[model samples]
Target: MNDKFFIQAGALLGAVAVALGAFGAHALKAMLETSGRADTFETAVKYQFYHAIGLVLIGILLQNCAVNAERYYHWSGYAFLVGVVIFSGSLYTICFTGIRAFGAIAPIGGTLMIIGWVLLLLAAGKK
Candidate 1:
């Protein structure tokens, strides 16, 4: 896999995370407070930041390591990308739209994130 793809995705995710965090802290503060979802929004941003960093690490590992172990990194990194969108995106949408249905999808993202971590573990064991 092209290392640039993972790196770019990670960078973009990190930048978006910061923007979303600030948006939550400022613009969405009042709404979230009124809806009692301030903590939930913050959680979404926090997890995004965490996975963004994880993606960057995956990119770095892929860049430096041999191709033999790229599959795990590839899978894990992509999983994280999807996970962030599904998990964090669900929370953000729910918080903003007051649509409780989105919450049901958050676990799928969380599960994907877990799978990413498990893939990372498998990648490590491969070495």
Candidate 2:
């Protein structure tokens, strides 16, 4: 909700993304390849990393935002966070569990990420 919260969340998410990426590259490499989900796993890691950075930027923007634009930043931050969790989380789940049903959820996450960017655009448009 607030700048501090988003900053903290972003930092934590970024750290986790790095850790997960390393784990996937090493420990899970054979399994992922064997399952033919290596690309999907990498995609999840990439999106997570990208959105973690976006979250940090949104947090910083919130910190410097005009009062009237604060709401947009707040919503954008939430959208980014939730989007990453859903998008990457679903991919990760599918990679590990081999449950293709989770694929359906990835679109929702992508949509949320898109909404986050749109909200960020609106916030930027504000004076």
Candidate 3:
């Protein structure tokens, strides 16, 4: 992806994460209280926000790298994206539906996030 695209996507995702967090904290407070899902929702928002920043960093790193740097950076970006979808998406579903299946998927998302960070570190280490 282009720098502009990555930057814009990051910004948008960051904004959405923030909004989701606020909504969970304030508007959903009562709902969460009733369902006992506040912590789960917060967890989702946390990872979403963290990966949103990762997305921004990936964009910045990509902008400064050589052509050969694209592979690792691109993989890192994809991993971060997958992390957000799987982690946050599963949390949201579990919170709303109380399904253990969603909870089961959370670890996969966390693994993706770890892999993304590792890939980013490897990319940076390359000289």
Query: How does each model score on TM-score?
Result: 0.95, 0.98, 0.93
Checking candidate 1 for backbone clashes, the offending pairs are none
lDDT of 1 by residue, 1-127 (tens): 5767888898998999899889989998998999999998999999999999999889888877756678999999989999999999999998889999999999999999999999988887765
Query: Which is the leading candidate under TM-score?
Result: 2
Q: Which of candidates 1 and 2 is the stronger one according to lDDT? A: 2
Cα deviation at 60, candidate 1, in Å, is 0.2
Tens-digit lDDT track of model 3 for 1-127: 6766667767877899899889888998999879999988988988888888898998998988877777888898888888889999999998878886878888999999999999899888876
lDDT of 2 by residue, 33-124 (tens): 99999999999999998889988998888888899899999999899999999999999999999999999999999999999999999999
Query: Which window of ten consecutive residues has the lowest lDDT sum in model 3?
Result: 1-10
Work out candidate 2's RMSD over C-alphas: 0.7
User: Between prediction 2 and prediction 3, which has the larger lDDT?
Assistant: 2
Which of 1 and 2 is the better model by TM-score? Answer: 2
Cα lDDT of model 3 overall? 0.86
Instruction: List runs of model 1 lying over 4 Å from the truth.
Output: none
Number of the top candidate by lDDT?
2
**Candidate 2: C-alpha lDDT:** 0.93
**Clashing residue pairs in candidate 3, if any?**
none
- Clashes (candidate 2): 0
